[model samples]
Target: MAEVLLVVGVVVAMFVAYNIGGSTTGPAFGPAVGAKAISKPVAAGLMGLFFFVGAWTIGRNVVTKLGTELVVDPGVFTLESSIAVLFFIGIALLVGNIFGVPASTSMTAVGAIAGLGLAGNVLDLAVMGEIVIWWVVSPIVGFWVSLIIGRYFYARFNRMVAMERSTGPLLDVDRSGPIPIPRVHETTNRRELVGTITVVAIGCLMAFSSGTSNIANAVAPLVGSGELAMDPAIILGGIAVTIGAFTIARRTLDTMGSDITELPLTAAIVVASVSSALVVFLSMLGIPASFVIIATMSIVGLGWGRATRPVTVPEAVRKEKAPPVTIDALAADEPGEELPPIGEEDPDKIPQASDLFNPATTARVVLMQNVVPAIATLGAYLTFRFVPIFGI
Candidate 1:
C-alpha cells in the first residue's frame, strides 16, 4: 500500500512538472521563435538544457525551502497529504487555463503547501511571511526598474537593439567538407545576426530562471514526505518538464510568441530581462518568485514611465502639469532619430492612450492571477482540515 501510494504521489508530481514545462516554454522562447531566429525544436532543446542546469544548481535552495523549511514539522507532508497538495496545485493550473490566464505555478504550489501546514498546525509563519513579502516586493521592484529604463533609456536601447530580419535563411550549412561548416547567409547582416543571437540567448536565460524557481513547485511535496530523495525527484521533474517542452509547449509557443509580437521587440526584451533576473535572485534565496506578476508589473511600469515622459519627476510630484497618457511609449523609434531631453519631448507627438495598457484590463489580469493561488490555498486547507480520508 505504501509503495502504491508513493507511486501515486510521484505521478501527480510529474503532472505538475509537465504543466510547468508547457506553460513556461513559450515565455522563454517565444521571442526567438516569433522572430524566426530559431525553430520550435531548437527552442525546446535549449529550454530543456538550461532548465536542467538551473534545476541542478540554484533550484535546490528552493526545493529545500518548500520541502523542509516552510513548515514547523516536515512530517506533516505524509504521502497522502502530499498527494492532496499536488491535486490542489493541479486544479489551480486547470482553473487558470480554463479562464485563459496562465497561473503562477510557484504561488499556487506554495499556497497548497502552506494550506497543508496550516491544517496540521505546523505552519511556519516566519518562513511563509518572508515568502509572501518577497512576492509583493519583487514585482514592485521589477516595475520601478523597468519604469526607469523605459523613462530614460528606452529610446537609446531601442536604437541599439532593434533589428528587422532580412529576407532569406540566417545561416547556411555547408556539408561539402568532412566536417560540416555553418556560415551566415548573404542576406543576414552583422546587426541582424547579433540581434538574433541576443533573442535566443535571452530565451535561454528565461528558461534557466524558470527552472530555478519552478522545479521545486513540481517535486517539493514528494520530497517533503521523505518518500522521494531530492536528487531523483528533481531529475524526474526535469524529465517531465522536458517532455512538456516538446509536446504541449508548442501551443504556448504560438500564444506567447503572438503576444510578444504585439509588444515591441525591445520592450519585450526589457521586460523579460528584468523579470527573469528578479526570479533568479529570489530563487537563490529559496523563494518561489512569480514571474507572471513581475513581468506584468514590469510591462505596466515600462508603459507608465514612457507615457509620463513629458513631465519630469519633480514636476509631476509638484503638480506642475498633467502629462498625457499615450501608447507611444511602446512605439519603436527609428535608429538615430534625434529626440529632445526627457521633459522637453513634445506631448503632441505622442498619440493618445490606447487599450494597450488599460487600467481595467490590467486590474482584471492581476485579479485573475490571484484567484488561482487563493483557490489552491483554500481548497487544500479545507480538505486537509475537514476531510477524514487524508488522515492529516
Candidate 2:
C-alpha cells in the first residue's frame, strides 16, 4: 500500500509540475517570441534546458526547506498525505488554467503543506514566517526597481534594446563535419545579433528563475515523505516541465502573442529581469517566492511610473520653458460658462494610461488568485484534523 501511494504521489507531483511549466513559459519567453528572436519551439527548448540546470544546481535547498523546515518534522509527510497535498496543488492549477487566472503555484503548494503541518500539530512558525516575509518583500523590491527604471531610464533603455530584423537567417549552420558549427549570417549586423541574443538570454534567465522557485512546489511533498530522493525528484519534475513546455506551451505562446496586455519589449525585459532575480535570490535561501505577484507588481510599477513622468524633452526652439497647456485653452467662444480649474478636468476626458490599471480590478484579481490555495489549505486542515485518514 505504501509503495502504491508513493507512485501515486510522484505522479501527482509530476502533473502539478507540468501545469506550472505551461503557465510560466508564456511569461518567460513572451518577449523573445514577441521580438521574433526565437520561435515557440526554440523558446520551449531553452526553457526546459535552463530550468533543468537551475533545479539541479539550486533547487535542492528548497526541497529541504519545504520538506523539513516548514514543519516540525519531515516524517509528517507520509506518502498518502503527500499525494493529498499534490492533489490540492493540481486542482488549483487546473482551476486557474480553466479560468485564465494566474494563480501562484508556489503559494498554493506552501499553503497545502502548511495546512497539513498545522493539522499534524507540527507547523514551524518561524520558518513559515520567514517565507511569508520574503514573499512580501520581493514584490515591493521588484516594483520599486522597475518604477525607477521606467520613470528615469525607460526611453534610453528602449532605444538601446530596439532590435531590427535583417533579411537573411540570424546564423547559418554547417553540419558537414562531425560537429555542427553556427556562424553569423552575412546580412545580420552586430547590433541585430546582439539584440537577438539579449532577448533570448532574458527568456532563459526567466526560466532558470522559475525552476529555482517552482521545482520545490512540484516534488517537495514526496521528498518530505522520503519516498523520493532530491536529485531524482528534481529530474522527474524537470521532465514534467519539459513535457509541458513542448506540448501545452505552444498554445500559451500563441495567446501571449495575441494578448493586448502583453508588455512591450523593453518593459518585459525590465519586469522579467527584476522579478526573476528576486525569485532566484529567494530560492537560494530556500524560500518559495511568488513570481506571479512580483511580475505583476513590477509591471504595474513600470506603467505607473511611465504614466506619471513629466515631459522632459526641450524642443529645438529657444532655451526657455514652454507654456503649459491648460483647460482654458479649450474654452468655448460662444458660451459664457466659466472654465473649470486647470486640475479639475473630467477624468473620463483625459486619456490617461493609469486608467487601465484599475486598483479595484487588480485587487480582485490578486484575491482571486489566492482562492484556490485558500481552499486547499482549509480542505487539508479539515481532512487531517477531523477525518480518520492515513492513520496520522
Clashes of each: 0, 0
lDDT of each: 0.88, 0.78
Looking at model 2, the pairs that clash are: none
What lDDT, from 0 to 1, does candidate 1 have?
0.88
Worst 10 residues of 1 by lDDT: 323-332
Score every model by TM-score: 0.96, 0.86
After superposition on all CA atoms, what RMSD does each candidate show versus the true structure?
1.4, 8.3
Residue runs of model 2 more than 4 Å from their true location after superposition = 175-178, 311-361
* Model 1 Cα lDDT, one tens digit per residue, 244-327: 999999999998778775678888888999999999999999999989899989998887777777888899899897765445
TM-score of 2: 0.86
Model 2: how far is 258 from its true place, Å? 3.2
